[model samples]
Target chain A: MLTQTVRMLGRLGETVVKGVAEMGFAAVLLGEALFWLAMGRRREQPVRLAPIVAEMTEIGLRALPIVTVLAVTIGIMLAIQGIYTLRMFGAESQVVPGIAFSVVREFAPLITGILVAGRSGSALAARLGTMRINQEVDALQVMGISPVRFLVVPPLVAMLVMVPSLSLWSILVALGGAGVYVSSTLDMTFAAYARQCLEMLTLGDLAHGMGKSFIFAVLITLVGVVNGASVSGGAEGVGRMTTRSVVQAISAIVITDMIFVFLVTR
Target chain B: MNGVDRTSSRVAIEVRDLVTHYGERKILKGVSFDILEGEILVIMGGSGSGKSTLLNHLLGLLRPTSGAIRLLGVDITKAPPREMQALRRKMGVAFQGGALFSSMSVGDNIMLPLREHTRLDRKTMEIMARLKMEVVDLAGFENLMPAELSGGMIKRAALARAIVMDPKLLFCDEPSAGLDPVVASSIDDLILRLRDAMGMTIVVVTHELESAFKIADRILVLDKGEIIGLGSVDEIRNSASERIQNLLHRRTEEVELDADAYLRRLTGEE
Candidate 1:
């Protein structure tokens, strides 16, 4: 039994290592595809253009109002906390720059990615994974359609086009809410706060944040497609993979954000 | 090969010593079969009998462990990507779940293959898709999503998509599964009609005994990864093997269980 357990442990370790290696290769391949997409090769199937439009509306556009409201609420919480801490330190004036940098540079995109991963990413994985496990992928293949080219590519293209837009929207809401808070509570001019945000937050800040969001968006969709493609066992298997996709996507976003922070901030 | 050689000499589909394994357990142990020009071969098996695995192997969806699978006389076991694509253009499969893309309407599902494999214009593809849908008796369902269709409707729609390309070989995995008896019989009729209309070879994997009996020109039954019986339905029924006899007649009624029950009562129920 001891030897069996040791053997099992060794196999588990090998499996994990192999999975990581495969994921690395997949990442390289996906990155190459994305790069080529940027260069040329449109490979767009516009036959389902209407459905793609509807899905984009449902996944990206519909979530905007909710995201805006959530960002405002969180921004207010951040302002209140910043005010209390800065008051104790006699450094209340830093509140504008403090909340502004954090929101525009990090919190806004990260929080929105997490929210969308929970809401949209899981839905994508579950919907696609269910289709996959039920043999819809095979059906597409037999139909001479590439499942990756059809199902995976469109949503990913939608994400690449929409996530940066969503992140920019999130940053605006957060900074706007912070400006309102500073004007009302700290007796500071809204113009001054807004000016500081514009001056302190460079294109670098916004671009870095958008870059992270874009990678996160791609990661979310890739995980969804991969998990969906690899699904087996049955319905319960799909459910489990969907849940894991969401969790893994969120974790991947956070880790990527940290790495981006280190690289950009350094 | 020239186009004439391809047309005259090509054997639609072939399988030789196909084996499939999941993890440690082997499911198909050197299974070999072929769908010749315009033949309908029904693969029958109890659950877990590897019929689906064999079908998947033929479809090039699952690579066999160590065997050759040829489609249209070209060995697809190591076929190049372009060749695989060309081979796929000449065949279609209807999966057990009737796996129509949930996101696409019935018309789109039927149109997808034409769009992928042909240079036909939108108008022509639309007409062809409509024609295929009408063939499957799903003409008005063009606008409906797969989610909106009933089980039998989904199956029929899938069949429509399968034949939309006028494929040389059609693979149907459990075409009658999870359908009403009337619908199952109707689907069998559709298979026959399609065969007659197109002279297309077909391979159907199903365990529904009645459906198998109805449509099969030849039947192959698998038990635990081995072919236990292969012949016409009449031959299978008259098989001398005890397992085949038991399956055909369903011999459970012959057992006398009252002896065990009486003994349990006499022994005061353990």
Candidate 2:
């Protein structure tokens, strides 16, 4: 029984240590990525603009159809829910302002974060993990190319640019959906619904959602790359880490969103 | 004879008393050897015999528990990252399973190191890449993706990429493991041609007795992480070491073990 307890504690300690080591590795990866991005040209190892653009097309543009469909559904649902909920207090007209404010400040970035974490974030992990298994990463190393600079930074740059744009796009599309619903279901014109939304929403409100997505982008990239770089056990390991990348990315984005909200409110 | 003559008898790689461990299990125990410029050193060992571990050490992928490896006059174990990178430009490694990047076409994969490391013109880079493909007999396959290639073709493409920059030191890890005998023989021929034609010092790690004999200027036989024999091919074949004989003859080993010690090791008490 004594040995059992000791073994349990040892396992727990080992987990904690591994977690810390993973974090350290991630921090170093991020640092190297930033360094290469900033100084790569001077050092003759420039983070090529071509790969970043390709990644942007994959991570952002290819995701457009789903983002559009989901945004519209979410907007319509929010309007229907908010209108009925506020009608209990005889404030049905207030639903326009409510939908606009919530979508811009919270829903847009949060939903997009989860969507992207499930989509491109999982792809990044799986791709990198497969490369790791194939020893392609080692091939890069022996050729004197830093694997982080070659593999991670392109997607890093792409994610940093594209996620915020997607969030902003989500905000606009969702508000449009809400406006259509409000115009059809109520006495308010679509123009009036849009006008009310414009009045209620501030530049700061737009920044709040876009800003949160910016942070989420970093979280997603870091989680994916870190899990990828640490993958072992071959094909099974790649699949495991790809799933973990999505889960951990979503959690990190949500927690970071909370922290951002707290600090912004302060 | 371009600058440094390949047959000048200079030591291209010098390993001294290399020691390593994984947890408490000692792997390479005070191993030492040298390879002359343009020579082919075949390191022969079975699985878990520490050849891979030693290769990783030589490549600077894994730091040894102790001792040093010098490649081209710079001690790799203690070299700075910048120096290592510079040294890597003069060295190439063709990994087991032909680790070509799946995302790139054969041409792109071969030219990757040049594109990353050099400031050559696009035309020059393309010409160099094509030249390597031709050298590895993959001239018409440049447009194909790595996934589209057969196993033998992938290995040849990997060899092309490894030698594209004309590295002075080349290492091939299990170059023939998964290929059929015909393909394997071709890979052996390619290794010999690379040495003779390019004058690159080569080290090949394999358990295949026939391939080693065909290509090795010298062979180093390792067993249980120790060098049981190191000599020319004929010398190694004639050596009286039972371990070397067993390895060469593909005989099953009947290891005599002390029961008490074995039990202690199994129980984690020793």
Candidate 3:
């Protein structure tokens, strides 16, 4: 019994140590990526533009349909809930501002981050993980190309440019959904709904959501790249890392979102 | 020539007391050797004999646990990233499985090194890639993806990519592992032709005795993470060592297992 307890504790300690080491490695990788982005510019060695545009199309442009559908659904659900509560005090007009505030300042960025994490993050991990397993990453290294600069930078740049754009698009779609709901259910016009939404949404609110999204974009791409680059074993390993990348990216997005909400709201 | 005469030749790779470990298990145990310039050195080993590990160290992909690896006059074992990159530009590696990027066409794959390292125009790069494809007898197959090619074609395309830059040093891992005898012999012939034509030092890691004997100027035999023999093909074939004889004759080592140990192994008792 004593041996069993000690062994369990030993395993727990090993896991903790491994986790810390992985996090340290990830931090170093992020630092190298940032260094390249900042310093590689002045050296006249910008990462190729073709892959960045391709990645943007994959991660952002292709994600519009799903993001639009999800944002609209969330907006309708929020309107239904908010109206039910507001009508109790004859404050149906308050529903528009309430839904708009939540959608613009919180849900839009959070949902878009999570969705992009599931879509693009998993793809980046699986693709890179396969490359790692196939020894193609080593091939790149032996060819005098830094795998980080070649593989990671394009996706990183794409996410940085596209995630915030997706978030803003989600906000507009959600507002449109809420406006439709307001026009049909209550005695409010779409123009009135738009006016209330605009009044409640300050530049601070937009920045707040976008800032969270930009950070989440960085997190998702880094987590994917790190997990992907570290894959071993075989095809099974690639699958395992892809799953881990998606789960970790979504969890990090949520945790970062919470922290941003706390700090920005305060 | 004797060991002294071989060592006197222009040294391309100088490994001394090289040791490597994967975690707690030592994969290479104090192995030492020299690869002469402009010669094909075949590293022959059975499974799990640290051949791949040593190749990784030579390529500067993995650092050794101890000792040094000097490639083309630079101590790559201790070289920084920039220096390593600069040194790597002078070398090329064709991996065991070809390692071609699946997404790219054969032409694009061959052009990758030139595109990354040289300021050659796209047309020039394409023409150069086509020239290499022709050298490998893979001409007119540039538009196909790696998955679309046969096992031999993929290997030939990978060879084309490796030689696209006309590197000073070339490393090939298991160049004839998964192919028919005819295709394998063609690959062997290609290796010889490339060495003669380009005048580059080549290190090939393979377990195929016929291929090793055919193309190698010297054969280094590795067994259980140690160099058991290093000599010319004739010297290795004429070796009196039972291990060398067994490897050449395809004889398996017999093991006498203790009953208790066997039971323990079967029962997961270690």
Q: Candidate 2 chain A — worst ten consecutive residues by lDDT sum?
A: A40-49
- Scored by CA lDDT, what does every candidate get? 0.81, 0.91, 0.91
Q: Put down candidate 3 lDDT per residue, A1-266, tens digits, no spaces.
A: 99789989999999999889878888888877777677665533457889899999999999999999999998888899999999999998889878978998899999999999999999999999999989999999899877777888889999999999999999999889878998899998999889888888899888988999899999999889888988988999999999999999999999988888898778
Q: Write the per-residue lDDT of candidate 1 for residues B116-214, one digit (tens) a residue.
A: 777799999999999998999998889999999998999999899999989999999999998999999999999988887897888999978889888
Weakest 10 consecutive residues, lDDT, candidate 3 chain B? B1-10
Question: Which one wins on DockQ?
Answer: 2
Candidate 1: residue B166 lDDT (0-100):
91
TM-score of each: 0.88, 0.96, 0.96
- Complex DockQ, candidate 1: 0.53
Lowest summed-lDDT stretch of 10 residues in model 3 chain A?
A37-46
Candidate 3, clashing residue pairs? none
Model 3 CA deviation exceeding 4 Å by range: A41-45, B1-8, B256-270
True-contact fraction per candidate equals: 0.80, 0.80, 0.80
Error of 1 at A75 (Å): 2.3
Write down the TM-score for model 2: 0.96
Q: DockQ for candidate 3, please give it.
A: 0.69
